[model samples]
Structures are given as structure tokens and as C-alpha cells.
Target: MQDLNPTGTLHIGASDLEYRMIGSAPADAPTLVMLHEGLGSAALWGDFPDRLAAATGCGVFVYSRAGYGASSPVTLPRRLDYMHVEALEVLPALLDAIGFRRGLLLGHSDGASIAAIYAGGVQDHRVQGVVMIAPHFIVEDISVASIAEIKAAYETTDLKSKLQRWHGDVDNAFYGWNSAWLDPKFRDWDIREYLAYIRVPVAILQGADDRYGTIRQIEIAREECYCPVDVTIMAGAGHSPHREAAGATLEAIVEFANAVLQGDEGARGRAA
Candidate 1:
């Protein structure tokens, strides 16, 4: 309920970027980093992170990327590489700054895509597992169609003003995400191949009614990865399982985490 933005800087390239971390301080506890959606930030998570930490007994970390909420805002049109930058570059720095060795990744929408990239790219110390909500590796006709509807609403409805409540620079969050996803070149984007390399456990949850992705997206993801993959379709829900059906989604995450931890003990354990 209280404002949850503990300021800390992460050095990336020539710039020192600051992140607003929020949650109970459990420096050594198994961590669970919250990655927000395309238009999301630390503030946008509301009380979900705190509640989740309490549920799992894992220290939760939530931060706004460079240009959302309290973080520095970007200038213009973004790129497909932006997600890569967040995962391979910024995320490692943040984990180090926070003294977290490895944690669970809880990502939604575009955040899920970035988490997928990070899962694939890590060399030695990586997350124990990942819980991706509505993750997409490739663009689909459904995604494009949904994005177009959002653009329409932003231009014609009160949605832009509503979004401004969560983002300090609403335009940066809006156009940067909208333009990149709608870009013609973005259609070929798919992280499933990269995800195949992920050695950690993964649970992909999606709403069967999700306008942005088809069932094929989840099917493809389930097929590519060698790890034990569990894909759940929240029948009546939409793009946001956490928002539309929080109870069911939280139950799924709890079950998934317990399974991963238990499995790790029996196996030889991952390469160190």
C-alpha cells in the first residue's frame, strides 16, 4: 500500500541508471524479480509484489525500466533490440546491485519476452526458473490486431489520460511500446528458439481469450523448450491473467515454484 520505490543506481555503459526497487528486504532470500508489461512500471504493480513476496517467502524486486514511472524516460521510437538490452545488459547489473545471485523471473507481456531472452543468454548464474505470463516470442496477426485497437483507444478514448496516472512520461511508455510492436519488421520476432536453450523450469500461462496471442503461441513455446514445460490456459481471461483472474494465476505460480524447487533437489543440479 505504501509507495514502494527504493532508489538505487545500476551502471550501464556510460550512464548510471537508477531503479526504484520495492519489497521486503531479504538480501539473501530467493529473489523474485517483477518485470512489468509494455506500459507498466514499478508503481503500476500496485500491491502485487508485496503480497507475492509474503506468499512465497521470497524477497520481491520491482523496478521501472529506463523510461517508465520514476526511471529515466527514453527519447523516441524504440527497437526490437530494446528487450535484449534490458535482459542481457540492465538486468544483470540490477541483480548485482541488489546482491541477488539468482531469482525467479515473473514477467508479463513484453516483460515476458525480455525474461525469455535473459533465460537464454545467461552463462553461469541464472534464474532458478521463470514464470512467464502472456509471453510471446513472435508477432501474430492477433497481436497486431490487438495493438491496433489500443492505438485507436489511445487516440479516441480516455485511455491515454488513464495511463498517465501510472507513468511519469506517458508518451514515452505509450508510443515506444505501441510503435515497436506495430512495426512491420517486428512480425518476424520470436524468442522460442532462444528459450529452447533455457535449462530452468518454465510455466507459461495465458488466457485462452487473450486478444494479443493465439493458442499456437503457447503450443510453440511448449514444444521448443526441453525443460519440463507447463502451459495453462485460463479460459475466460484475457491478456492479463493477474488482472483478470488473480487468484487462479497466483495459485499457478505457487504450484510452479514449489515444483521447481523440489525438482532441483533430486536432479544433479544445473551447471555452476
Candidate 2:
């Protein structure tokens, strides 16, 4: 692994995504591609990627999707199927652009949903496994209610300022996600069907006290996915377990990646 500035950018479609690639070269190890939360950016992930790289010996690629961080801004009133677009369109372009041959798709919050959708929808062979942290498989009343509260905080509190530190155009990042979820029609937005087709191993991690979602997300995965799933519900954490329960989250992720990748070379060799 090289020691370099944890900041760089990639041009994907009309968007210039800000990213930081950590750990060894992609050719030397599996690349753990990270997708940020709804209001998250590469910066918001803090030292978790570094910790993950150190723990798992895998290259970590963390990027901010369009409308977040220094990535390109997005048009407002984003469609409810925005996650689908990202999963089916943007993520494929990103993986190809980065020359990803084999890796894990690791996502949090909305990012997790996108990863799940891509893994199940596209069924790409390059993806060896998925690590979904605080994923939402379907719309829930608790989720909407909490998101509504976040909307209020963004207006009445310094939440905007806090988020602006990470997002280039904070409103575009915030409202693009918030508005779509709050939309009446979005209540019907569901990606549970995507879970059934995922062929690779999956690790689902959630905070026990997560205000944004419930254990129903894990139950949905267990019921739907045909692949191996490792589930962990951290006792004292909240929405951001990687941040709130860093030690446990890191340990679980490291173990999961190693186990999944252990026989990858043998499997690929046999297939070839």
C-alpha cells in the first residue's frame, strides 16, 4: 500500500466524483468499494476506511456520489427510482472506470440499498460479496418519521452547516435524498425483490438502536437472499455503527471479508 493524500476525483458520466482510494493496489488485493449514506460523503466516513484497510488487507475505495462532497451537483426533485438508477447505471460505470476485477461492495444506509440493488439486479461477476450496513430493504413508517425529523433539523438546526462541511452543495445532497423519500409515491418504493438474486456472500450490520430503520431489514435479507449472510446487531450503536461502534464494526467487517475472499482464488481458477 502507498501513503498518499486521501483525496482524489473521478469523472463518471456528467459527474466528477470525489474519492479516496486506500490500501494496496487493486491488482494486489481485493478492492472494498464504499458507498456513502444518504447524506454522507467520503469525508464523513472519517478513519473507518483506513481502519478497514489495515484490518482486512484490502484496498478501500470510498467515493461521494453525485450531489455530495466535491462530486458534481444533481438536479433537484430526484426521482424515487434514483437508487435504481445509481445501482444499474452509475455503479457499473464506476467499477468499470476503476478497472475493478474482484471486490466487495460495502454500503451504508441508502448506499447499502444501492449496493444490494446492483448486486441482485445486475448480477455482476466481479462482485465477490456485499457488506450492507444499516440497509433499508423497504419503506417503513419509522424511517419516514425519522427522515422528517432530519428535514426539520436541517432547517431549524445547524445540521446544514455540519453537512456543508462534507457536501459541496449541501441542499442538493440533502434534498435530493430527503425530498424523494418524503414524496407520497415513494412510500411504495421497495427493493426487496433484489435480495433474491444476489449470488455472492453478504454481511448485514446494523446498530441495535438505529433510529432510521429496524431489524426488519435484516429479516428481509434472511428471508430473501439465497447466499450466505452474516448479521450483527450492535448493542449500543445507532445509525452510523462504523462511527458509533467502530471497534465492533471494524472487527466484523474484517472477519467477513477475509472469510469470503479466502476461497476466491481457487474458485476463480477453477472457473477459468
Candidate 3:
């Protein structure tokens, strides 16, 4: 595993993912590995990672997936099961590459879905909990509509230019995610089955008025997850609660991380 630096590139297979590390490293503290949204890059997370590291006293790692940010570009028209591929393939290598000893997977939007899939599909004991922000368990009509609208905006409006600020291959990043979701076959994209396999505690932060997904995402998690599930509906917030209600979001995650990591420590002590 490479050394954890404040900012660096991690070469995973053919992709060199861009990453940022804040506060202590995973060897000295429990880490929070953050997965960005579909169009989000490592830099797009803004100061949330820094605030999270300060609040929780845990290392916060943020990385941009392939085709996003400064990462390597992927072939256009991503597969319908791209999230699954990320969860099963990329994430495991990423965790190992980072020398992650103990940590929680924190994800937003597509990133959230990837985290959930990993927790459920892979039995990695290093991960003790999950924090999902605006996660989607299944494809919703609203999600399709919003994605379609964004595709239109990307083509005819300044959305592409705006996104270009974060992504190196702006078109690849936008079209890869946009084309896959807008594909008719993507309507059947569902990952609720993975929820049942997640062994760690899960915390979900949902926006009350998110345009992309509804409360049903939370409902699916409640129904599918056998582990402890904590849900916080952030009122007056939109799709991105950490961006829209930063303080509340940080507090909620900090509280959950403390409780979960402390409990894990206690359990380890008893075992010892």
C-alpha cells in the first residue's frame, strides 16, 4: 500500500484515481472513505471532508472514480451494472491499496449505492459501518426524469462548462453516467438484495425534497437491511444534504461514527 498523503494519485489497475487525505491516517485512526456522487470528483466534495475529519477525529479519504475528476477516462455508455462492478471490483482493491485497517464507508448518490453494495456483497471485516447520503436502492421514475433533464441541460446549457471545472474529461464523465442511467435497460437497475448482506451498522441521510430520489430509498433499506439502520430526514435540504445542510449532516455523521467506532473498540477489548 502506498503512503497516505494530503493529496495524491492511486494507481488501481489501469486507472489512476485522485484522492485526498485529511487528519490522521488509517493506521493511527479509524478512517472514513468518502465516495462522491455520479458527476462528483474528489475536489467537488469541497470542505466537507476536512470538517468531517475535525469533527470525528478520524482520517477522511476522498477519491474520484474513473472517468471523473482527474481520473482516467472510461469508455462511453457505461454498463447498466456499473455500480456493481465498482462495488465488487474497484472498491476492494482501493481499500487494500490505502492500507485501510478499520473504517466506515461514507458515500453519496452513486457513491452511496456503491458503498452499500460493497458492505453487502463483500464480507470485509475492516469496515465497521456505512454512511449513505442520498442513496438509491432501486431506480425510480423521478431519478430517470431528473437524469434526463440533466442530459438536456448538459447539451444545451452551461452545465457541461460548469462540470468541466471538476472533471478533466468532462464529456466522458457526464456522458458515461448520463447515458447509462438514461438507457431504458437501466430502469431495472436494483441493488436492494445487497442490503440484506451488509453486516455493519448503516446510517442514511436523506433530503426531504430531493428531486432525484424519494423516501422509498430509505424504506427499502429499512426493509432489507438486517443490521441496525439509522435514518435522518433533513428537512429543507435537496439532493446534497452535506452541501445544503452542512452542519446538520456533519453532526449526524459524527454522532454515528463515534457510536459505531467506540462500540467496535469495546468489542475488540472484550475479545482480547
Off by over 4 Å in 1: 1-26, 262-272
TM-score-sorted candidate list, best first:
3, 2, 1
* lDDT by residue for model 3 (90-165), tens: 9999998988999899999999999999999999999999999999999999999999999999999999899999
Q: lDDT per model, in order?
A: 0.77, 0.88, 0.91
User: Taking the tens digit of each residue's C-alpha lDDT, what string does model 1 give over 1-272?
Assistant: 12234656555554445455544442545667889999898878777776576566566788788777767788688876789888898877777667765568889998998888888887435488889999988889989999999999999999999999988789888998999888888888777778788888888999978988888877887778887778888978999988888878877887776566554332112211
lDDT of 3: 0.91
Model 1 has an lDDT value of 0.77
| Global fold similarity of model 2 (TM-score) | 0.94
Kindly report which residue pairs in candidate 3 clash with one another.
none
TM-score-best of 1 and 3:
3
Two-way TM-score contest, 1 vs 2, winner: 2
Please identify model 3 stretches exceeding 4 Å from their true place. Answer: 263-272
